[model samples]
Target: MTPETVIGFARSAIEITLLLSLPMLAVSLVVGVVLSVLQAATQIQEMTLTFVPKLVAMFIAIILAFPWLMDKMVGFTRDILLNLPKYIQ
Candidate 1:
């Protein structure tokens, strides 16, 4: 571990984290925005009205996206494991 090698590993870890998280974050964001718009249009300011739809949508998205998420995680893990010797120094 030279500094550049450490930095590269850190960058890869960050990128993998972001890639893994993006699906859920994006789904939540889009669902929240859409629900907020609908709530505004209906003037249903119940406050708690927002939670159910977003939660359900995110849950459904996660369920549907689970395989792809798993594959990404597995690939990242494989890469890290394969590169262990490089980090060992």
Candidate 2:
């Protein structure tokens, strides 16, 4: 593995990681923001108010996105495995 090959592997890993996490992260962010706004409006400043909803939303997001996530992960793994011989050189 040359430096460029190593870098390429690192970049692909990072990209796949970010892509896989994006759905849950986005869901959590949107839920948190909406909860924050609602809290502000109702003047209910409970610190724990946002946790449950965000957790649920993120869980739903992961559930809904699981197939797609698995597909991406499998493809990345396949590609990496397929390229292993080339990388070994």
Candidate 3:
């Protein structure tokens, strides 16, 4: 209802988003760096060399982290729903 409340909600949403994406982002970053280093060492300058591995790693990360991600998302949704009346007031 208030600007401060809106800002708080926005901040919470952003934090949740970042938290949810962290696993995949981290995996992708690490995979990319490692692949880049390997490519450099092997002198295999293939532009698409990192794509499949990064994708697979990201997918695996998402799958492995799915339960935790879902739990966090559900908790956030529950909190928002529980506080909806206060927000409306």
Candidate 4:
């Protein structure tokens, strides 16, 4: 494949990765911030206090987003497959 095509593939890969991870990351970030604020307000400074909620939120986010994530990944895979001939040439 040409350099431009390679770069484009890499760029798309990164974008897909970001898209797939966005919901989970966002959930974790929001959870962390909210927990931090709560901890500050309540003055309960425990490390796991932050971790457990973030984990659960992230897990829930992933579960909720899983179908969309699968669709995106499948679409990307199809696109790559459909473009395989072009890359080969």
Worst 10 residues of 4 by lDDT: 51-60
Residue-level lDDT for 48 in candidate 2: 79
- Tens digit per residue, CA lDDT, model 4, 1-89: 89999999999999999999899989988999999999999999999999988888988998899999999999999999999999999
Residues 1-89, model 3: lDDT tens digits: 99999999999999999999899999999999999999989999887798989989999998999999999999999999999999999
lDDT comparing candidate 2 with the true structure:
0.93
The local distance difference test score of model 3 is 0.96
The CA lDDT of each predicted structure is 0.88, 0.93, 0.96, 0.94
TM-score of each: 0.90, 0.97, 0.97, 0.97
- Looking at candidate 3, the ten consecutive residues that score lowest on lDDT are 45-54
Top candidate (lDDT): 3
Number of clashing residue pairs, candidate 3? 0
Alpha carbon lDDT at 71, candidate 3: 100
Off by over 4 Å in 2: none
Per-residue lDDT of candidate 2, residues 5-86 (tens digit): 9998999899999999999999999999899899999999887799888988999999999999999999999998998899
